[model samples]
Target: MAAGLVELAGVGLEVERPVRTRILHPIWLTIPEGARVSLVGPSGAGKTTLASIVGALQPASEGEYLFRGERVDLLDAKARAGFRADNVGFVFQNAHLIDERSALQNVALGIIDPTVEADEVTGRCLAALQQVGLAEVADRKAALLSGGERQRVAIARALVKGPRLVIADEPTGALDQTNGKAVLELLFSLDATLLLVTHDLAAAELADQVVTIVDGTLA
Candidate 1:
């Protein structure tokens, strides 16, 4: 197999103490650069957990996770944070916008580089919103936008960082069918590598690879 942009080998998650719980079973998978991979499973399955692991949001309990040949699971907390900030952008089920902030400000949150000039950040954020077809609403408060518009704002936020990987967890779950389809199309159009976690089988069809998990193991 080709070396993966993201790789997992025998990775598993377990909780100990009052009660023992195994959230994910040891499994192996390799995703090449620019691959569009979708993960689908039953409600309680470990799909989101796996996405979190690969996105560097959480560390695997065992086995190794590598991103672009670096063993990310072994990185210290600060290093991991830096790695995620620099390379991973995540879109969740909810827009998760700060209601008080304008669409531009919400997207600007993705600009983690403190040294970037304020004007430059605003310029980049405006461009990102425009890319997602939301430039007209750049100054609108997130609270005033419709659900679909808000999600677009979230997408612009994710893309503003110019991440190497985009981790989307049920990104279209909250939208109507039309909005969901639109959101999925926009997400797939991005040039970055994609790892999508969704319950929608149709969404999986858009990916180059579909992985199904059942009871914490690949099914």
Candidate 2:
């Protein structure tokens, strides 16, 4: 059977104020396996909004979204939660780790495996951290890490799930030149298909396709 990784057909969204203004138009895009695609546009150009739809975090106002060929544009709240847990991982502009937990614990939260033992989870988390060259800091609390270190931990968390597709939102927005490159390297290292939202033209060049969004439309 053919794998239908992600498909957005005639998707449209609108953010209305009390005046009912239309903010976003329909977007049509597709992502096949192992394809690294970057969505680029200026702020408020609906880039993040589009990513949210693909991640199944937001329902489409008018369109169809298929993940692995399953219709997901209209799932209810609970079903969307389950669908995301099984098929997707998101790395936002911020690390979003729990400050109270250790670095390894934060990564384990990505999987939420009920069957996996605590020690086993730690092992997998540690392994992922090591892959990001963060093994030595695995036991430290998330609050104590530097911004760059925290982002690496976030990257490790996203990879630990072994998701089919990884969606990153400005994965390097908070890092300096050196740290941004480090985080970017770790993100692309995953064999999974990558759909990243970045303003960096340089990073976008590495993608199989560079989709530029302008004024809520693809240019």
Candidate 3:
């Protein structure tokens, strides 16, 4: 078997504030390069938490996380942020775009490296928007876009940096059927490895493999 691009060994999470609560039970998973994996589960089943851990947005409270043979679970916050900037793209159910920003500007925010020149950022952002079929509205404020358009813009933002992995959490949950299908097609067409969390079986079916999470453990 090919080596995994991402691997989680006995990974889990817990919260200790109000009361010590286990948010995720230890689980193991592997995702090879260029593979598409879907995570399906009931609400509050820890799907999003697992996606966050894989995306480097949060650390696993136990066990190890390896990405491309590197130990990601050991990184500090700043280092983890850098790792994510270099390798991961994320899309959520909500577009989370700034209402006053133009589509191009919104996409440009995805480029986290401060050393990139302005013209290059602009060029890259425009290209990303073009890829999502939103070049015509590149300069339009985000508030004016339709629901589907907004989600497309979100996708463009996620793709602007040419990430190796894309983690989408309920990406099409709020869309109409047609719009949801379009979004799923767009996501599946990307060249990167995909880790998707969704409740839609049709969307999940598009993945190369589907895994179920129930009440914090893989089922």
Better of 1 and 2 by TM-score: 1
Q: Rank the candidates by TM-score, best first.
A: 3, 1, 2
Residue-wise C-alpha lDDT for candidate 3, range 1-219, written one tens digit per residue:
767999999999999989999999999999999999999999999999999999999898999999999999999999999999999999999999999999999999999999999999999999999999999999999999999999999999999999999999999989998999999999999989999999998889999999999999999
- Reference-based TM-score of each model: 0.97, 0.93, 0.98
Superior candidate under lDDT, 1 versus 3: 3
Each candidate's number of clashing pairs is 0, 0, 0
Candidate 3, superposed: residue stretches over 4 Å from native: none
**85-137 per-residue lDDT for model 2 (tens digits):** 88788888799999989999899988766998888888889998998899999
**What's the lDDT of the predicted structure labeled candidate 3?**
0.95
Name the candidate that leads on TM-score: 3
Model 2: how far is 55 from its true place, Å? 0.3
